[model samples]
Target: MRLSIISTHKRIQKGDIGEFEKLFRNLYSPLCHYAFRFIKDMDSAEDIVQDLFYNYWKNREKLEITTSLKSYLYQAVRNKCIKTINHQQVKEKYNNVLRLQGQDYDDYSSSNIETEELNQIIESTIDELPDRCKEIFVLSRYEGMKYHEIAQRLSISVKTVEANMGKALKMFRLNLKGYYQISANQ
Candidate 1:
């Protein structure tokens, strides 16, 4: 039960650390980018790729590959990204149930707790953003301005505003991950 890259016939015996390392080095970045396309977060994408490689190495002797190594790696990354998304969705659903049940963990009213924590997370995440991106995001979201309006106010193109807003929302999603599990990501 040894793993082999079927197309290249590159046999991966348990002791072949050099070959394994080479494969990892060759594919890690590309796989991370591929995962990022699905998850929209670099950190989570890298984690997914790294975890895939780790598990691939851990059970090398017990695994079988029916496709090219690259294909297998890509498929694994895609599956893991989808799994992560699904897991996040499930957590979001659970959180929604808690919210609906009116479970209060502190002194604030239910609405106030969610709003305050949400605003805090948004502010902290925005604080970490680049200056221009932060300004654009604040204009579009906090100020309730449309993209075109924000762009005009900042004297930038609407496309620029859209790109910055995308970056900001991506950052927000990444930061909220494992912290808030808000229903919006659902």
Candidate 2:
């Protein structure tokens, strides 16, 4: 499965299936190992490598390799692993904050419990809101979407998003005020 550096580049550029298969066979395991160094999960590492190869193949005609193909593959896997880890971290942090704010736990009477409870109260309150207000609130708060982006996604005007969000907030304040004070004391 050996290919000269120049031949590999030319074969890939020419969309040669044989060379591509040879390249995949040669590179796949090593790239997965490289990804595992960062992510420490075999499945995720394999997925990242597979996606890298798929994208590589998909963009073969337009792809440029200033470095060796091996180097490019390694760099791509490294980047993908980093991105995956970062996204996971952001999600965990967001969940932690949400739980803390929502009163979602027990046993320790710690912030976690308060967050769990608060979360339930908030969800119920949001569910009780009018349909449009609930949608707008979820989009803005839970989805972390900007008002304008929400409007664009829902095919509404920004002003409508603003008005709905305002209504949602007022409803939340009225409904969750007692829960908020109780959680504050905990």
Candidate 3:
């Protein structure tokens, strides 16, 4: 039986198209069913089995089948199924990684927009402050000046400087929360 199988394989290798067709007719359905057991999809199983036969025929000159033809065909079908499953897994992983990267890009873009909008709101709010309050706020924040230094420089009471700083702080707090709502809603 083994010798007959090998001889048949050799005949197919020697460009025997009729012999190859007979072998394919005998094995194709069984091979597809065998592949479906592993892959769980009839269409994919049929394709895999068909591809296996096509590749075997195309590369017959380079291939050697040491076992019985039945064993060789079964083993080849199993290997093709495993390869298909592995390829599908790789494609799924690649797609998942792309999705995560897309989300990261979106977050980075929104963060930049939020920062720019907050800066504009802050600048406009600062401009609206009472002139003395804005000056006090800028000096305390931008120039890193202490309250007493600002009061002496402006020839104002320390209490007056403190009042102006409090009003500026309150305005900023309200704007900060308002900006948070605007960004969150969008």
What is the Å distance of residue 30 in model 1 from its true position?
0.5
Tens-digit per-residue lDDT, 1-186, candidate 3? 232566788898898998888888888898899999999999999999888889989988788888887898899899889998999898777667767777444566577788898889899989999999999999999999999999999999999999999999999998888777876798
Computed on alpha carbons, the lDDT of every model, listed in order, comes to: 0.81, 0.85, 0.87
lDDT of 1 at 86: 99
TM-score to true structure, per model: 0.51, 0.54, 0.51
Q: What TM-score number comes out for model 1?
A: 0.51
Residue 52 lDDT in candidate 3: 87
| lDDT accuracy of residue 91 in candidate 1 | 72
**lDDT tens readout by residue for model 2, 1-186:** 444558897888898998889898988898888899999999999999899988998998888788777777788888889899999898777668768877433433475567788888888888898998898898899899999899999999999999998888898889889887876785
Q: Regarding lDDT, does 1 or 3 come out ahead? A: 3
Using TM-score as the measure, the top candidate is 2
- In model 1, residue pairs whose N, Cα or C atoms come closer than 3 Å (at least 3 residues apart or on different chains), thus clashing, are none
Off by over 4 Å in 3: 1-3, 103-186
> Could you give the candidate ranking by lDDT, starting with the highest?
3, 2, 1
